[model samples]
Target chain A: MYSFTKPKKKQFFKEDTKLWLVFYAISVFLYVSFALFLLVKAYFYSKNNQIYNQNIITLNTKISSLTLQKENIKLQKTIYEDIMVKNSLIKDSIKNLLDLIPDPITLNKFLLKKDSLIIYGITPTKDVYNLLMLPPLESIFTKTDTTFYQMPNGWYKFKSINKLKGNNETAFN
Target chain B: MKLPSIKIKLPKLKIYGIDVIKNALFFAFYISMTLFIIAFIIAPSVKIFKNAKNSYFLSKQEFDNTKQNYRHILEQLTKLQNQNQQILNAFKRNFNENNFKLFAKDYMNIIKITKQKTIPYKNQFAKTSYIITAQIKSPKNFYDFINNIKNYKNIIRVYFPIDFEKSNKEINLTFKIETYRLLTAKAEEKAH
Candidate 1:
């Protein structure tokens, strides 16, 4: 049922049409691939951002607490230094009080309290204690009383009680 | 390999000795398709991609700065702790009565140490005291004891009601020794 012509293969599409379609498909593929790559990169970046934000919050909390701890250390140092200074003052007061005793009086015992001091001593005469020891005690204490007992020997035994009222005790001094 | 050759037959009719109408229609189609693809797909995608890149860089820089700040704070904290290491350690130590007696052995003879009531001090510390009766040869011993306390292992405050009584040749020294310890809620929990 054919004429005397060479038989040709069936053509589904023209050559130029196929070429144009391939070009368009490549362009679309390249665009889609690039867009997808960018989206994946953006997703990763956002994830990293969230992680870093969380880390920042935790670090900030730690930093604040560390600062508080530093302040606390400073407070401890202040307390320590104050206590040391108070201790030195106590020592100085005790030294000064001990140095107050004169040669005429022989101290038997002395009770040093926060607000009061009581001294028991032997004096060569009542006048010796009254002249030397009584004046200093009277100067330091708010109230002072002296009781005398004559010893077997003419030497007098005197008990002096010194009292400090209110907060004017001047501490141990 | 030999490729198959294909062809499409077009209308033979022409005007003005050329296929100007068909060529113009083809050119118009290509131009419109190019403009449509660029505007609707590629341009929008590119813009979004650029914005994402910018955001990523911004977040990265912010993270770097925050990390630097954290490191700086950490370093400062370490330095402070190191500088006050002795005082901080002393606050944490518990007062040992036997150790204290041994420490005071050089200064005086400790006859007795009676424990007193414990009280809270400064909200974060516990103050416990002992009424101590000791014997010393002279006032110099008491002076030395007070001075050397600065080098002791525990933090202590010598309080009031100190008495010095001369009994025979020896002097009886009675005083209150206050020892402070860190008693924070965290430390209390650790104790339990």
Candidate 2:
């Protein structure tokens, strides 16, 4: 008891106490609201993650499928170009063979097979066919056989067969 | 042993209608509530946020990588098709005898083109063989015809059993040609 102060009753909830209570309420509200905000953000993040995962799987599958298709097209192109090259080689080979014929010995009828060539033509003499046509045929083929028949006009009709052994050489291209 | 006791008096505040004694209890209640919420709700919420963030980052990385891979494959496929445009078109082209004859009219005279049979090739293509017999003035026509096959609409291949017989003045050429083309489907949609 103070001599100069008036007698007063003590109040449990003073102005300062109420103010402190309000502060505490505000602090708790802020803490709880922040937690709730974090929870909502977490939920959205999880949802977005799930969507991204699905997209990733779909994209990977598509990528793999496209890769396979690319390989297939490459294979097709390889085969197609290979055929074209082979066709060109065959053409060149036939052209070279036709250009091998000499003028003096006429190639009346010729048979060009896959592995062999049969030439039937007329020559003034057997010696002319042997000297002009037989040497080149022997050079190009693995084997050559020529049969000459004496014609009524004193000329010779010759049949020559040239074959490629094992069909391994590029002779027929 | 017995210890001597000392009496000590602590001041107590007295109020009329306010229970000042219970203030300590309320203060403790506020502190306890705060602790409880922090332990039960806020902690778990923070944990959920952290876990979800981590998962999202991982998935995002994977998604980005997959997207890049898809783009790369698509680019490669388009480039491959563009590089082999002629080959692709030739594979898909159908064989037309009349059109081919007209195209070959400059090279040689096509006597006949009889389609022999159809067979499967490479599991995705069909190969049809044809017996072609024609007359040419010289072997140069045959050479030009074969050379021009590369530029033809359909892919053609010359097979074996090719014969060249001299007929009177003109030369007779008999040969087999195979045309290769795509099967039915499975390459159109994804390629585009």
Error of 2 at B105 (Å): 1.3
Per the 3 Å backbone cut-off, how many clashing residue pairs does candidate 1 have?
0
Residue range A44-91, candidate 2, lDDT tens digits: 999999999999888878987898889889988889889988898788
Residues B107-172, candidate 1, lDDT per residue (tens digit)?
999999999988999999998989999999987899999999988988898878788878778898
> Which 10 successive residues of model 2 chain A have the least lDDT summed?
A164-173
> Highest lDDT among the candidates is held by which one?
2
Chain B TM-score, one value per candidate, order as shown: 0.72, 0.77
How would you encode candidate 2's per-residue C-alpha lDDT over B1-192 as one tens digit per residue?
Answer: 889999865345558755565566567877988899899989999999999999999999989988887888899999999998988888887899999899888977899999999999988898999999888888888888888888898899987767787788788888899999888532663377
Residue B30 miss distance in model 1 (angstroms): 5.5
The TM-scores of all predictions, comma-separated, are: 0.74, 0.76
Candidate 1 lDDT, A101-144, residue by residue in tens: 89988887777677887888889998888898888888888899
